[model samples]
Target: MTQAVAKEPAARPRRGPDRYVPFTEHMGVVRERAAAGEAVFSLELREELLNNHGRGHGGVVMTLLDCAMAHAALSRVNYEREVVTVDMHIAFMGPSTGKLVATGRVTGGGRSVCFCEASIVDASGDVAAQAMGTFRYRDAA
Candidate 1:
């Protein structure tokens, strides 16, 4: 037997993912682009988002990565469903300065789960953080 696949959303003007996520909005995280099994998000380092050393706070980094990875998982299903991070492990490389970009890709998984990896690079193109995560799919409605 085979399972049915989800339908994709209607096409729209080229921009960020056509969705409004309150937390992402509150943190100023923008979904720059998304495709099947891939997604990229970005955020500007603000005073409140920075740690004492003038780098992005750990919470900020983690949230950005989680969002990006979970989106990647959702995209694999044509975004017909939502995904939640079941487990995630992140490594902070060094100070993240200027605008930061996080890119996520679906490594592997089955229908109900996805494995993803993401990395954050600063404006200077230095890697500031990397993460691996597991996400489980759920109904969008």
Candidate 2:
């Protein structure tokens, strides 16, 4: 008897993978989940995403953080609004050996910009990376 390989279902499309203007084209990062106006982004550990120690790459981590923070900021805005990253800083704590996910949310908000943070955890739920960011709001319709 031959075993059949099961395929996963396609994701529902709502918006562009990258909502930020500058990083819009870099859909290289994947948005695995989104709900409650929040987003969870993930990516498989690959050689390109590995550092000298064969762990999660810093650039990859930064990208994830930026996307997560941006999504979080956008979520806080009024109807049909956008935002731009003003300042972002990420601190890498440990190595991520497998698939990684970043959960992001807005910590503070105002008329101009919002403050956001995201925690990038490994499959084991260990905090591998974290980021703090600020975003400038765009005009809303």
Candidate 3:
């Protein structure tokens, strides 16, 4: 299937010094409902986000996982600051199609590091991919 994330992409290069979610002219990949650290971001999937075989690209899946993981990690923090991804492991279970939603929750919290896990679901409500990640609270550093 062709899984595409069709939200207006940020003008910033994917790999750049300003990697901490650049503010975009458009709502871009990041939105309010998805920013509260509790809600999920739903992106419409299309062929552009597909792989060689036309399946959901691993990069897109990983990005979604990372975003969700950050949200989950942020839920444990009381203050606002950047949280760097320490580690992230994702397991692709099924092909992602249509609207892809990702939800994250904190598994554990600490003074220095936080552990979180998130799952990406397809339109059919099946988990297309799951992620477990650890993040270091920027302010805590």
**Candidate lDDT values, in order:** 0.88, 0.76, 0.70
Q: How many pairs collide in each candidate, listed in order?
A: 0, 0, 2
What 10-residue stretch in candidate 3 is worst by lDDT?
A: 23-32
Among residues 3 or more apart in sequence or in different chains, the pairs in candidate 2 whose N, CA or C atoms overlap within 3 Å are none
The order by descending TM-score is: 1, 2, 3
Which candidate gets the maximum lDDT versus the true structure? 1
- Ranking 2 against 3 by TM-score, winner: 2
lDDT of 3 by residue, 32-118 (tens): 343334536556667777788766788887887777677656655533555889999899999887778888777886777888888
Q: What is the overall TM-score of model 3 with all chains considered together?
A: 0.73
Please list the Cα RMSD from the true structure of every candidate, rounded to 1 decimal place.
11.2, 7.4, 9.0
By lDDT, the candidates rank as 1, 2, 3
Where model 2 places Cα greater than 4 Å from the true spot, the runs are 1-28, 35-37
- Highest TM-score among the candidates is held by which one? 1
lDDT of 2 by residue, 6-60 (tens): 9885554434444333342343567765544477887777786688999987887
**Where is the poorest 10-residue window by lDDT in model 1?**
9-18
Better of 1 and 3 by TM-score: 1
